[model samples]
Target: MVQTTATRLKNRLRRTDGQLQGILKMVDEGRDCQDILTQLAAVRSSVERIMGVVVAENVKRCITDDQLDTDQQAQLEAALELVVKNH
Candidate 1:
């Protein structure tokens, strides 16, 4: 199960990487600035979503491990908040 989750996350990151490359190519081709910006925004959102998912998974693991103290939970929550706000 852990291996599956890692694989899925890796796939998500790879797809996001492709989108990033697409944005770079669009810029190189002198595509419409507005269109490029829109696509870039999408890429940013996709990365942010992936980050949120990874953070959630980490939080779940921490809780299950019984080793995550209050400070650790607070830190994770803060990280989650940052991702949510940025996304």
Candidate 2:
């Protein structure tokens, strides 16, 4: 079995996705508002962490290849900005 970083990230994201679906079902089932809100907040935090991992991975790849162009760097910054803004 070949274990890759991308595979790990993908697996983590899939688990998070399942958690999100369960949260949605809880909301639909009329669970307590406070509880649902807490779960939603957790989901947001998980997503942010995932995004950070992805960004770090990309930066690592770029650094390894010595190909971190200005445009790519700017795009990465913009993505970070969007994630922070939405959060």
Candidate 3:
């Protein structure tokens, strides 16, 4: 079965949550700082990936949506440009 974007994002978020829990456990157990930092990096990357997915989906929507007025389309394009530049 093909998973929708929402489903994919939810799964990614769950994995990120699990990574965070593991980091907490590592801290409690006095695990190596390097190991904890590695996990933290992984979680950060996961979150970034989620953000990219969301932005890509929104961009696609903006391009394909035909009902948007000219002003709304311009606003969305500007907002998307800002997000891309900041990201």
Candidate 4:
């Protein structure tokens, strides 16, 4: 079965949540600092990728939407730019 974008993103989020839980367990078990940092980095990368996908999808939708007036389109583009820049 084909997965929708939302489904794929949700799965990614679930995996990220699992990674966070693992990190917490690692902390409780006194795992090495470097190992924890590596896991943290992986989580960060995953989240960034999710964010990119979401932003790209939104931009694609906005660009293709025929009902949006010029002002609305500009606003959406600006908002997307802010999200990308802040991330």
Candidate 5:
């Protein structure tokens, strides 16, 4: 993975982790349902963004990596399929 992508993913993951902890605390403290749901939505969005980055990085590698041979095109296709199917 590219350094910038890795850093972005890590930062987003950390934010989501904090959001998850906050959600747990809210549940334990009996906070408002709407507030908790909002936070949870934020976490979901963060996770989706990270997933996008992962797929993008893989796609970039598939396009630019000189290490892959002609025979490895199938492998690249499979990887792309995984990313697309998941989405």
Candidate 6:
């Protein structure tokens, strides 16, 4: 993955991790259901965004890899299959 994209994704994941911890604390403290669900949805959206960045970077790599041979193509295909199968 490109450095900038990777950094961005990592930062997003860190935020999501914090959000998850907050959710846990909320559950432990018996917070309102609506607020908890809202935070949960935000975390889910952040995760989805991270997935999108990863897939986009992989697609870019596939398109721009000049040394891609038959073996590499097959590997790319398998990787793409795994990505597509998620969610």
C-alpha RMSD by candidate, in order: 5.1, 6.2, 5.4, 5.3, 5.8, 6.3
Error of 5 at 22 (Å): 0.6
The candidate that wins on lDDT is: 4
In candidate 2, which residue ranges exceed 4 Å CA deviation? 65-87
Candidate 2 C-alpha error for residue 83, in Å: 13
The digit string of per-residue lDDT tens for model 1 on 2-86 reads: 5676898899889989988998999999999999989988888888888777777776676753667888878877876777556
The residue-by-residue lDDT of candidate 5 on 1-87, one tens digit each, is: 556867877887888899999999999999999999899888877787678668867776758657678668678767666664455
Worst 10 residues of 5 by lDDT: 78-87
| lDDT (C-alpha) at residue 19 in model 1 | 89
| lDDT tens digits by residue: candidate 3, 1-87 | 999989998998999999999999999999999999999998887887788778967886767668788898788777776664445
lDDT of 4 by residue, 1-87 (tens): 999989999999999999999999999999999999999999998898789779867776757668788898788777776675455
Per residue, candidate 2 scores C-alpha lDDT tens digits across 1-87 of: 996978978887898898889888998899999898888888788788777767766765766334668788777767766654454
TM-score for candidate 5, residues paired by index: 0.67
lDDT score of residue 54 within candidate 4: 90
Task: Give lDDT for model 2.
Answer: 0.77
The CA lDDT at 70 in model 1 is 84
Candidate 4: give the clashing pairs.
none
Q: Name model 1 segments beyond 4 Å from true.
A: 1-3, 65-87
Decreasing lDDT order of the candidates: 4, 3, 6, 1, 5, 2
lDDT of each: 0.80, 0.77, 0.84, 0.87, 0.79, 0.81
Write down the worst ten-residue block by lDDT for model 4.
78-87
Instruction: Report how far off residue 58 is in candidate 5 (Å).
Output: 0.6
